[model samples]
Target: MHVVATAGHVDHGKSTLVRALTGMEPDRWDEEHRRGLTIDLGFAWTELPSAGTLAFVDVPGHHRFVPNMLAGVGPVPAVLFVVAADEGWMPQSAEHLDAAHALGVWHGLLAITRSDLADPAPAAAEALAEINETTLGDVAAIPVSAPTGSGLDDLVTALDDLAGRLPQPDVDAPVRLWVDRSFTIRGSGTVVTGTLPAGRLRVGDELEIPSLGRTAGVRALQCLGRPVTEAGAVARVAVNLRGVPADALHRGDAVLTPQRFRTSDVLDARLDRTGDDPLPQHLMLHIGSAAVTARVRPLGSDTVRLTLSGALPLRVGDRGLLREPGRHRVLGGTTVLDVAPPALTRRGAAAERARILSTLDGEPDEHSELRRRGIVRKDELKRMGVPVTSRPVAAGWVVDEKLWAELRSRLPDVVARWRQANPLETGPPVDVVRQQLDLPERSLVHALVSPPLAIRAGRVVRDDTAQVDHLPAPVAKAVDELRARLAAEPLVAPDATQLAELGLGRRELAAADRAGVLVRIGDGVVLLPESIDEAVRTLRTLSGPFTVSDARQAWGTTRRVAIPLLQYLDRHEITERLPDDRRQLR
Candidate 1:
């Protein structure tokens, strides 16, 4: 299915041509038919020769309803540019053309209406020349009087050709349905209608209204007024929502795939002029079905920074139009360049930013994207419309190539400085490195480790350095003396007085424990690793459950060390304690 919008001046027979083509009234409101003019948007559809089902979004041609007309054509792709044979290219005709061309409507066919009133050849030739100057390069112009139906058959053929020329919609793309019309039904809750240019929508799909920070379940779907479980792109659709108020939604709101788009009020765009005039500082922004006031800051000759009045779900390469608020005309067309641009804080920042923006086109280039952002999550890069094909340095984290290299170069020095200040420990913890470097993920910190720097027991260290080398010389000597004394007497534990005499303070003892020189147990008690091994072996040889007193006497250690050691053995499952206060080796 395909959708086309009718564009022309007032009383140019746009609705008449649509009514003649579809046997259906394009106008929905009674006010439109009473005044014999289209006020708001109108919709009608019919099956064509080669085009399966083509829908028409008939817009008002009068300058007063220009905003309503823009809301209709802003989302539609192709157009049926209408011209009256008697009146050649009037004021509203030129404004309508400018609006359509600014919104980047490329596929279209011109219809010369009222052919019976005047010569059709002149009107057809002039409208085609104006259209070809924009993206709609060349198209067939068909002259037909809707009343007399002179060339209706030829116009149908041209419509089919235009439909075939339109690029196929991507069914797998993320859904972004701009709500053009939203109203409540008596039995069914709220319903919204919009043109689905790309992506698929299914019943019960959870969708988001980003600007409002709301989520709704799709209760039902309709395409061309037929109820269906699902609908695809390039067709008009109406959605029944489960959990929202009809009054909360408006023309500019969009129903989007949750987490798939970022709603931003500030964006950088590349502007292309529709004419030779300089773009104004303030304009109206028309995108999808929404129009909002925009304040523009010129970044370069063809680039701009727009601060929108409302947030919209935007991505790179999306096209929109900039129009003067008062004039019934379009100022220029815009292609989004960046949705997450950096802030300008310095006096010369805007100029420097323009120089950077000059290097970027509207297309999403991964290298240029990463160069500007330094690092970003894979999910956000996808939302920004950048394709990330390279392997992530960490889980769901991508770092720029040059930035990764710089991080690698800085790691060794960072570890060295931390170790120097903390002489008793190997290095700073991984989480500490993450905070110091302002990295988002711990896996990213691990990815920065290389040969010289290694993660040892959760702290970074030199791979070639021995564990004792991380301590000061005096602390190392103290640890060696304590180990020698424990080696002579297997179960003799040191008291705090003995430790202080050896100058092994709390930090020194902890450093020695980490280095595997000693194992700390109860308060003021320290033993060698081999001594614990020997004690475990001796306990198993006892036939019966032994009391703590019996073990203390056998090892000739004091009661203070023996009790805590027995409890530690029980905690580690090396021994089971009896109800009578005795212990047995497991």
Candidate 2:
């Protein structure tokens, strides 16, 4: 389907031409027909010989209704430029042409209407000259008289040829339906009408209003006044939305695919001004079917920062128009460079940002995108509609492959050096490894350190690091003597004084504990690792819940060693402690 919007001066027979072409009235409101002017947007569709089906968004041509005119044309890809033969080019004609140029509308057909009232040749020549000066640039012009029905066939043929030449809309793009009309049906609920130039809308699909932060389900879909299960791009569609009230919506509100777009009030963009004259600080921004007041901050010769009065769901590479508010003059065009732009807080920041934006001029590829963002999550990339052509370095994390390779190459050396600097530690902490590698995500560090190095006890360590078979000679001798003594009396634990006599200080005991040679039961107390097991085995022999005294007598140990030992068994859940200070097997 081909959707085209009409653009020209007021009362230039745009609606009449549409009615002639479609054999249906374009004006919907009674006020429009009574006043002989189009007050709101009118819709009409017709079958063309070469174009299959074509739809017309008959927009108001008056200067006072430019905003309404923009809403109709912003999403439509092609235009049916109307000019009255007697009127030639009027003020609104130039303004509409400016709007088309500002919005980057390139495909169009020029119709010199009311040709029966004047010489069509002269009017057609004048319109063609004006169009050649703008981006439309020498498009096909036809002379037609809607009332007399003269030259109407030629106009349809021209439209058909123009539509055939238009590029196909990308159906895979994200859906963003900028509603021009929204109203509630008595029994069916809320319905919204908009021109969908790209993407597909299907019944039961979920869509969101980003500005309102509300989501709704598509209850039904309609195209060309017929109910449809689904509709694709370049067609006028009406969607019945479930769970959304009519009052919560307005003309400029958009129904979009949630999480696919970012809403921002500030945008960094490249501006193509109509002239070299400096733009005013304040201007009206027209994007899609919405227009809002904005403050412009010049970044460089052709770069600008627009601070919008309200958030718009926009993405990088989207285009919009900037106009002098209330003046009916288009100041320039904007191509979005960055949505969610960085805040400028210091001097020369704008210049630095401009430099960054210069690098982001065109559509970015995968490698460049990764390099620009430094690090991005896979889910974030998917939500932003960015294609991931390469495999991710880690789960849920995407890094520049070149950067990852460089970082991975340095990991072994980094881990080895860290081990050398802190030999007492099990390994370098994960945070320390991340810092040394200058990586933003801990997952990246884990990915790079694995295989060659392994994570041990929450720290990254080399697999080849020497394992301690024995402690220093003096400590080993002390540990052996203590093990022998504990073997003879498994329940007995050395006190602080006895531990010092065996040359087992706090540091020595801690070393023995790590080596699994001894277990530290309490402050300044050490026991063989088997002693706790032996105590549990002995306690099981008792019939009922045993008291501390009963456990001491059974283990044949004094209260000093017995008390801490019983506490250790309770801590390990080998025995349960009762409120009455009794113990039992767990």
Candidate 3:
């Protein structure tokens, strides 16, 4: 189905054209129809042989009502930018175009209405030239008169042709249904109407009211006024929710997939100065269906930091635009940097700029999305325009390549620091590394690190490189003393306490063992590999081969030392243990 919205200056025949094509009144409010002006969002649907079926959002064209228009146009991909032939392009018409472009609406057809009242050819040509300079310059424009139905068929054909060319909508991502209009039903609960960007919504589906922080169930679903069990992307649908209040929602609110989207107030964007003038530091920000005052801070050259009024969870790369209400000028466009921006006062300009630039320009395609949005859900990243890779172990996701590189470089540095500070320890502990890098523990081991380092079974190691640095003073002393002490009396190996006295504790000893500085011959008994070699030689020379008792007496030790020493020799394949507990070379 094709979803399109009507946008233009006030009283430009957008509503009249909608009524003529769909035979339904787009003006929902009694005051609007009585006044013959569209103050709120109006919904109508038409069926065309070429386009099949199309839903229309007649957005308010007045400057004061542009916010309402944006809410209606937010999720739709195509639009009917209506302009009266007599008026040509007015101030509000230009603002609507800017809003459409900022919201990322690319495909559209221009409808020059009221052609009977005035010649539309020249005006339509001028409007077309203005639009083409922007993203929608190549769109088809049809001149029509709603009062006389003049050129309506030609307009329908143009719309049908545009609809046919639209890329197929992805319904498999997270559900983001922006509420353009909401009301309460007597028997059912609150009902919301808007375009579905992606994901499927079915009866009994739980949707979270982001502005309300509450979850509601889908009691019933309708598409184009027909009852249905489910609705997919690119469809205009009305959802009856189970337990939400009509008062709790507004035009800017959204019903989204739960446990996935989050809210933030900080946005990073690229501002396009409308008339060759940079946007002032303070201006109003209009996005989706809501408008709020925002303070802008330009970074480097193209990026800007936006401090918003309320918490808005916007994920990285959410495309939006900025405008000043009093000025009615396009400040610039922006993608989300940090939805919840850090405290600006506490952060210096350079830091703030870096944070904003990082979100806007850095890592456009590497790490999975980092921002949590209120309207979009977990699965939406893959469903939207983002490119994600899917696997059996993990679902497909969006990532910023530059972020991955930064992480890869920094992660190993953190691990190296941890390992250097702890010589007696096995590589850096997983939890420690996770906290240092601010990365999830599940992917910690698998996370890429520069020099290709990794933690293997709690032992940190450079993938192909062995541990190389000399032991620290304390650990080094312990290693030297233990080796000297073992050589002086190979029969009696010192326990953990003995090592502790020589500047090593159990933890340090364990670390040394992992580092291969010392080997444990038995419980609480350590043997330097060098000492073990000497003991094995002595036993092998004595009587050619010896029993456990003979080796014990020859080494001047008890069965404890003799037994482990013989076992250690056997393990190294230096000797074989016989049935009578004797040791001999194979």
Q: Which has the greatest lDDT?
A: 1
Work out candidate 2's RMSD over C-alphas: 4.3
TM-score per model over all chains? 0.93, 0.84, 0.69
Report the Cα lDDT for candidate 3: 0.73
For candidate 3, write residues 1-586 as lDDT tens digits: 7888988859738888999999998887888878878898888999877768988988898887766776777778888899899889888888888887776678888989889989999889988988897767688889999899899999988888888888898788677777777889888878888888678899999988778878889999999999999888889899998878657777767788875565666666665555567558788776666667788877656667788886554555676677766766666566664443444465475565565464445233323343322112225543233344532121222234454466667876777787678765657766777577675443533545434565565655666554323356667666777777777776687766676678776666676677676777777677776777677677767875578888888778778777887787788787887777666887
Q: Which run of 10 residues does model 1 get worst, by summed lDDT? A: 514-523
Candidate 1 clash pair list: none
Best by TM-score: 1
Q: Residue-wise lDDT of candidate 2 within 1-586, one digit each (tens)?
A: 9999998959739999999999988899988988898888999999999788999999999888889998898989999999999988888898899889888888998998898899878878888888888778879888988888999999888998999999999998889999999899999899999999889999999998886688999999999999999999978999999988767787778999877877889988888777898788999999999999989999888889999999988877777889885677888778887775779999999999888877776453566668877778765655544667777778778888777888878887887787677544445788898999887778888788767578865677656634333356677788889888888887777777888899988878876776566888888778887787787888889999989889889999898888888888889888898899787888
Q: Which stretches of candidate 1 lie over 4 Å from their true place?
A: 275-279, 450-452, 514-516, 529-556, 563-586
Worst lDDT 10-window in candidate 3: 390-399
Candidate 1 Cα RMSD (Å): 2.6
Give the lDDT ranking, best first: 1, 2, 3
